[model samples]
Target: MSLVPTVHLPDDLAAALTRRLAATAPTEASAQVDRLIENYRGATPTAAPVLRDAGDAAAYAAYRMPATYAAARSALAELRARTGAWTPRAHLDLGGGTGAARWAVADTWPGESGPRGTVLDWSAAALDLGRALAADASAPSVRATTWTRAPLSGAPELPAADLVTVSYVLGELTPGDRASLVDAAAGAARAGGVVLVAEPGTPEGYARVIAARGRLVAAGFRVLAPCPHSGPCPVTGTDWCHFAARVPRSALHRQVKGGTLPYEDEKFSYVAAVRPDGAGTPPAPAANRVVRHPQTRKGQVLLDLCAAAGDLTRTTVTKRHGPLYRAARDARWGAPWPPDDQPDGVPDSGGPDREGAV
Candidate 1:
């Protein structure tokens, strides 16, 4: 499996963060980061804003933003691969504290004018810091992004947009609120729009994402990336579908986390669904999706896949398979199987169950 390159913070944003961190004492920032970690670990259905002040917000941006940005980028990449020629003109990011999703969107479709972006969150501190960070962003979209204060409970109605993103926010909402928020997103998204919900890769996070996926499908949206079919998820019991994004750690991130590692892999579960309102041709789903990293040993490669037939399967490719084996050797988790460039007319190697399952 190919190793995804470590995603780094944009230079402009990195400089902005450096300037913000320069004013705060390292020890104070470190202390606040520890508190944030504690809060996040047990932050389900938070009654109030976790970021209570500028200090807290700044600490969070320094520590969590890079990882969140990476995860969002990975999910967006998958969505873009499936939605060819579909560029969103407007983007709505719900509960987007530091505007990580907006950054991901802008990076995903660069060179274009970029989407008109708006980030809504309940925390004034987070909004303020996000605004400051985006004020001098190199990307025009980021510089022109709007930050608004709003509750996560889907009150006052959300603004209509071509793209809606809910990332790392569901865990902080009650069950009722989570459903309400997703419904609101479905209601506000324009026809042919896209809504992506992402969460930490933990089993609980996967549960939340899966629930949201069902809600979107019920709302008439078609499942895109991650799941090859709109049918029931084949992953059952102890197994959950998830992907990982490697994020390069900034100096402040290392200091705040107190770790020596130069990078961290942020595992995430996500579902990208589109409002198939008949504006364009309905895209075809992938033949299969790589659910796990391809495991290669000797002349054979073992692949765990979620097939379009609505099942989880493990297939093996031996050296004798020629070009197919080469493609298998280059396969990466979360990517479509038998990539578009692979030699045509390759025989099927995806039947029956193997020793491994995802």
Candidate 2:
């Protein structure tokens, strides 16, 4: 018996997908279809080894929540606008979770000219959810094609495509696994292909984004979004850059959390990298101005208020001293004094001024 029960697709979606499958089969598409079927058959409701609880249907549902899908759609739209007139015939969605990204792609790029996608994830339950969602969409008569029971560690040889999407999956992997996945995705992109990677907004998540950025850059990928490529992270390197978005949570999520509104606040870092015909080197960082500080007094330590908009502030250190350690670590003062007494009225200058010394 399978750990997860068989997933049933909505009649309309399933029928449409079957019709589309018939058109692509017999020679080239047969093998792909068969592989997908076999994988789905082997996938049980039970979770994979990597997840915390393979058998917890509620947990699986939360994992495949709809908020993620909406975000993926928004990200894809942003990518399409930036990448120009490139259209995809096939799509590979790594760590797709519930196949929300796949369904979003189908819905956004519908019709005969729209692309076909392969939803890849380690969880069979998640894949099952993806199939159901794809079938539910009002897309053209096309098979909601998918392959389950396939782990990212041993992903099958994938067909090349114009676009590839890997959203909200890198954080789960160890550093080594993250690197390997990126290398594989980059290698799989055809000439003039684009890859979109999205993750939660957190300091660690941003670090992963940076790592991905480095790997993609080294592999000759050009960044299309998020300007000022090289600089101190806006979040002070404490968290990733992210925003809040509204989306429907899955059935499992509702059952587990007992909430109806599927909206979520996710912190994410994303990048759309493309292999251009003749891409140039990344731009250099901009220059900033420097300012000097005034002299210190017996009771007052000079502080460089230029950076703080010329507001001389004082902070006391020892119990008997006026202020210390503002300009430098080794700074000390005998007592407290006003800011005007210091040279240039700037703080932290080392000049000797004994007049009105504390």
Measured by TM-score, the strongest candidate is: 1
Candidate 2 Cα deviation (angstroms), residue 162 = 1.8
lDDT values for all models: 0.86, 0.51
TM-scores of all predicted structures: 0.94, 0.58
What candidate 1 gets wrong by more than 4 Å, as runs, is 1-5, 154-156, 343-358
lDDT of 2 by residue, 40-102 (tens): 345322334333222332233333334555556655655664444557777888878666567
Give the least accurate 10-residue stretch of model 1, judged by summed lDDT.
Answer: 345-354
The candidate that wins on lDDT is: 1
Model 2's alpha-carbon lDDT is 0.51
Specify the poorest-scoring 10-residue window by lDDT in model 2.
283-292
